[model samples]
Target: MKRKLGAEDLFKINSVSNPQISPNGEEAVFIRTEIDEKDNKYYAHLFHIQLATGTISQWTYGKERISSPNWSPDGQSVAFLSNRDEKNQLYIINKNGGEAKKVTTLDSGVNSFLWDPSNGKIWISSKIKSGKTFTDKVEKEDKPLPKAYVVDGMKYKMDGIDGAGLVPQDSYSQIAVLNLNDESIDQFTTGEYQHSLQAISPDGKKLVVGVNRADNLDYVFKSPLLLIDVETKEETTIVDQNGYYGGAAFSFDGKYIAYAGSDHSYKNATHGNIYIYDVEGKTTVSLTDGIDSPVGDYAVADTQQGISSPAVVWTAANELYFQLSTMGDVRLYYATLDGAIYPASPEGEHIYDYAVTKDGKFALIAVSNPTFPGELFNYEIAAGERKQLTHFNEEFLKEVELVQPSDISYEVSDGNTVYGWLMKPAGFEEGKKYPLIVEIHGGPHTMYANSFFHELQLLAAKGYGVLYVNPRGSHGYSQAFVDAVRGDYGGGDYTDIMAGLDYAISQNDWIDTERLGVTGGSYGGFMTNWIVGHTNRFKAAVTQRSISNWISFFGVSDIGYYFTDWQIGADMQDPEKLWNHSPLKYAKNIETPLLILHSEKDFRCPIEQAEQLYITLKSMNKQVEFVRFPDNNHNLSRTGTPNLRIERLNQIVQWFEKYI
Candidate 1:
């Protein structure tokens, strides 16, 4: 008998990502991630696959997590980053498979890296302190054991996977070149600004870097493009810091460089565009000027840790490909240097990551769907034949009853058609009424897409029908639609969701409207709080890592000060406006029983946001419960410790089961 996909299945689920195709396209290397439930940790190992024979072999084995696997241009060696030594260091292994050798030993772990084909050199971006060698700085400074922080600047500390509000830890990430033969490191760029390695010219003469040199404290939005001479280390600003830009690549002949970016004309809701820069002319032109979709995956998730999605994938000097979010999916689009573009992958599936062959005849795509975790597929570029190459979860999935969501649409008040999906309860029977849970997504800007979501699946297994929607202000829509909820929070956005719920209820007789519950995190959490305050239609609500007061969020959150201004259109300058939109202002009206779920160290929407709402509701004699997870961040649901993740899902399911 088939069993429902429950919370414990998280341990059985195996996922693959970051398929790096060799130069000859004969083989590929990708990372396979599995949850170590016994230790409550996550682990990843590199695996190699032969394209012709479909033969697979493990390349590395260890407790350390491996990421960013890159094939050498000559295809003789592969390099990747690992945390075997407690800090992320560079490791290289032969193509034939043998013991991996450590390439670099830096006190500050490598954040990201790129390989220079012309020379056996590696370019890395890492955080380094000033005035001392990184190792000496760490040792001599005797970093204070402070439970308190002396906060400084608009952006002081960052939210790591660990926790938040810990310390005012700051470091400047700069570029460095490491010579493999001599093992000598050369620091190229300097300053307080952070730099990221983007791309190297084909001849390895020029390097492209994304540098954020914004002078003002409040100007945290721009990252300009910089071209550095590999030898002289001289830098030229190819693109001004008037906006954000990165993911750069040079043409095969090294005449033009292609990059992705956007001018902040629309602030946080601006769609990204592709641009080409002529090295000789020193001029840049936008290739995708009128496209309504974001250039890359703005709808992000913490599904797989240590995996990165490249912004632009160039198949040729004249032909390039990139992913864009549209409707409820992130689709791959092929474009020419002249700006013509069309979809390259299937329309309805999410392309998590992809690798193209040198001749551009084939592509290795990492794709996922509503019922699929993630799998690799080989696609013939010309014939459009997509063949599944790997089935990591085939055995486990075969014995489970997975719920498939029905794509639905409804017209909201603003005349825009909102897209959503209604997932039936697992092992459903016709005409049987079931409890409903209206699940909301975070990013307020990010959308619910055609991807596998473990939480929703687990909830469905508990016999709850899940309703999730891409309302206004979601990424996978038009620029105007995404920007609609910025200045007008809790206005039309709320109506769009309610309208979707109403539409779903009207269409399905099996939905027990009286037993409706709601839950969401981050912005979704804020919306859940908002919904309970405005209406008591939900019998139970769980708000996770949510925002309650914009005023305090502006001060405590890692991105608070500026994100408040960018998203809500109000900052410290406008207290009344911020307060008016805050759900805390209306907390006394909440009648539904609320379960507040928060991470003690969530710097994005600090846990204090949850505290304010919970305390306010309790003060009003409302039924409320707050649960705090220690050493977790805003991504508690997606990337927390495996044990905590299972517990979180169980809590939500049990809460609804008890109340609804």
Candidate 2:
């Protein structure tokens, strides 16, 4: 007999990411992440695989966590970043395996770095105090002490950087070149502005960098791309500061540049589009104008850290591939120079992370589904055949009876179609009534897909039927549909979710309507609060890291002030409009047994959002309880401390079990 997935099973799962195919397309390397349950921390190590033999081997090991593994141009050495010396610095080791040697001796560690096209030098992105000779000053000093922060901008600090504290707003990120032969560093692109090197040209003469030259008032979301001359130290604007653009790269021939970003015409609802720039013609074109899907992995992944899948991968100068979030799945698609788009992935599986070989013959993808966790697979582009390469979780998966969800669709009041998934409880029986739990995803803009969701599976394992939907405000729909909820937060989007639930129940006879529960986090949490206040249908509800008052949210959240203006169409200038959409405004109407879950250090949706709702419900003698996780951020469900993540899931499961 197989057992249902439980909270503790999280410890057994391994995370795979950052697959880099060798130059000859015969081998590949990636990072395998694991959690030390006793230490409550995560570790990442390098792993190698041969495409022809499927033989896997570990390259590096120990307590140090490694990331950003890359192969040298000649495939003779592997370079990566590690925290072995208590600082994230660059390290390189031979391909045949041996002890790694440190490359950089900077006082302040490197954030991210990339190998040069010729493998002669490397460009590193690192933070340094902004002043004259600041790079040299930091190199001479010991571990610098914490200084008082005088914040002057709305985008000063964030939660995930170093836990719960305000960060230094004065320190700027600078790019430096390290000569591999001489071990000398030359700091380039200096000033008050911050620069991040994205890609280098094929000849290693020019660089694509994103620079923020604005003063105090402007946000850094729309930094312009600059083409920097490596030898002359001169800069030219490739894409100007009129819109949001980043993740830039030079094509194989250095004639064109491909980047993933968008103009902020629709604010938070704007779809991320892939734009290619012609360096020679001085023109740009959007490759995914009609796709209507987000041009990257917007869906949350449950991993040791928040892993970002590559936004664009170049197969050739004329052909490039990118991942798009459609409905709930992140699928791979390729675009040609003549403006043709086609799917490059197997159907019904989410390509969370992928990398194409230099010859464009094979692609290594981290694929998963409702019943499967992450696994490495090699996809042949022309033959369209996928072969499994890594089986890190095969043993655990074989012993677990996971619940597989069925795809569903329904029409809302406005005749717009909504997509959703319905999963029966584990060991489900025919004609047996089961309690239902409506799971709402965060990023009211993010959609639910056929991906493997650990939380949903745990809910199903605990004997509750699950239903999750992508409403009007979600991606993977029309642009008009995605932008539909910008000004009307709790209006049509709420109706769409409710209609989806009714349709789900009507289609399934075994769902017990009276024993219904609902839960969500972030924007989804706001929707859960909105649903309970507007209706008395759900027997129980749990809101995680939610927003109660948009008025206060404007001043507190990391992106609160501008996010309010972008998503809600209101800011500090319009307090009344902000309050009108606040869920706390209708808290008096809530009678469902409500459980509030929040993180103490969440800068995105602060703990105060949960406090206000908890206090309001308690003052009215309403049934409510509040739970808080210390030292965690808004990513508590996705990438929080491993034990806390399991506890958070248990809290949701126990709350629904008690009330339903």
Candidate 3:
């Protein structure tokens, strides 16, 4: 056989995701994605999985992939948005399926939708003109104009698709009330922040949306909740008591609205807290109180995306069932309007997100831990029993050893306790000294939960101790705790992670601190870059998809403009503040060998940021090399092209082997 580069060899298989049970709760509908190696593309389709008999069936086919499916409350049909007609349009199908019927047509199409309680209507968040009448020449009148000269997606240029369409940024979004009967559309709040999460109240009249009308709304991490009295055309802020408040949902009675929110600090340790606002009483209470859990553990394979849209399942007698991840492991926890919260886990590993049955006796769960990938499981509360339904990755686990993360709590310099997870070598021996790799997570707003990450586990198997932490900005902590790291990015949160390292070295005698190495992507990438510049504690580092210069990052990155303001309360326009928060400001102090791995087409971080770091490191005579993957996005490390994914792993191994 010809010699093959593992990074160039493709072995990734596609997976199914976003499974949602029909309104009637009979069968689960999921989006199945397949990667075609020939074109290096992912094709998605809607598939139906039965809950009772474990039967599976395929629904859509051939031309386009269907996404974001919502079932009509009557359960007779399902509505989905797709790019099937070239422009994304609403398509509906019967309970079983015959042919999907097109339900709406406009110049721009739908991106997301919610069924209007079986009133033959669907509410979608899609681009629409502010005041343009439905009858006007829409393509000419309402089609978006480029807000920024070079749109981020589809490369840096607004390349003409046969001059067929405008750049996506030129494409603006609005929440539209789509009346399925007459194909009539009503625009709600043409006010600016690019509409998202259009949640209709249980009664289907009050629409709870994430709207940003303020000019500085762009500075906000997430849009504040906007409630619209659809019939009266009156709009009001549900609880504009600020700071990134999008994931809002109404209680069964519509009196209480629960949402997932985080304060305005973008420090690396931010985790979202559950907040409930009483509409009638006009009061707000921060739930997920005291029970802090890491969102996604560094032990798991993920892009560091934290929990948004907390899976809130309704209860039989007016209570709400939700999942909480305190201590980095997810568990099924239920709470009522009466203020009582209790555990509902009936067994091992841990419960994923819970699915509540209409009758409240059943809780459908996706369960797993370090040893297992999530499997479909069910808990019958009335029967007081739980059983595993389907094994998702049992075959794969048999081929490889999975690492079990050990919970570790240590104190910060401030005398505050911090939590983290330690993944030991697979066939660990107590006496052997192993090199330790600190795998940090991004999202300064995300977490390092106790999930499974093939990379971290594989690192441990390579005779390295893997340590991941919740380090403050990480979720599963108190809202105030998460908010603590903002503006103080490299301040306290930095001290926490470093303190974590110090504690680990002091506690674990087997860790070779001299052989220490570190690496992370995005904010973690930012931290990795920050760590090397601040101290030479780490011998080597790999910063993937990171921002080295916050000043330049604002204009170049797709999210930099907003991300900067969210993290530090100012954008690059405020160069003084931006520079003060940037890792690049102190680059001359960086002595550690740094490897910058970046995607060629990552709009989120953009390749330029990586280029700047790599160039500066080389100029300073520090051993540095940049590995740029083509045709990849911000998801380069977690969910990128297969050939490139393994290559990323191989590069990390090579970097550590050479430097440390």
TM-score of 3: 0.82
lDDT of 2: 0.85
lDDT of 2 by residue, 1-660 (tens): 998889888888888878989888899888888888998988889899999999999988788789888888889888999988888999988878788889986667888787898898888988887774424754444867876667666677686766554666667788888889988888877887778878889899999988867775445567789888889968888787546788887888899999988787787678899999998797998989978777887665464242556778887646888998887778899888789998887667778888997667789998888888888899898899889899998888988889989999988888889888899999999989999999888887787777788888889999999999888888876789889989899999899989988999999999999999999999999999999999999999999999999999988888887889888888888899999899999999999999999999999898898999999999999999999999888888877888998889889999998999
- Candidate 1's C-alpha runs over 4 A off are 133-150, 161-170, 300-302
Task: Supply the global lDDT for candidate 1.
Answer: 0.85
RMSD after CA superposition, every candidate: 1.9, 1.8, 5.3
Ranking by TM-score: 2, 1, 3
Local lDDT at 619 for model 3: 85
Off by over 4 Å in 2: 132-147, 219-221, 303-306
Model 3 C-alpha lDDT per residue in residues 518-599, reported as the tens digit of each score: 9999889999998998999888899999988888888777666656776777874689988887888888899888899998
Weakest lDDT window of 10 consecutive positions for candidate 2? 132-141
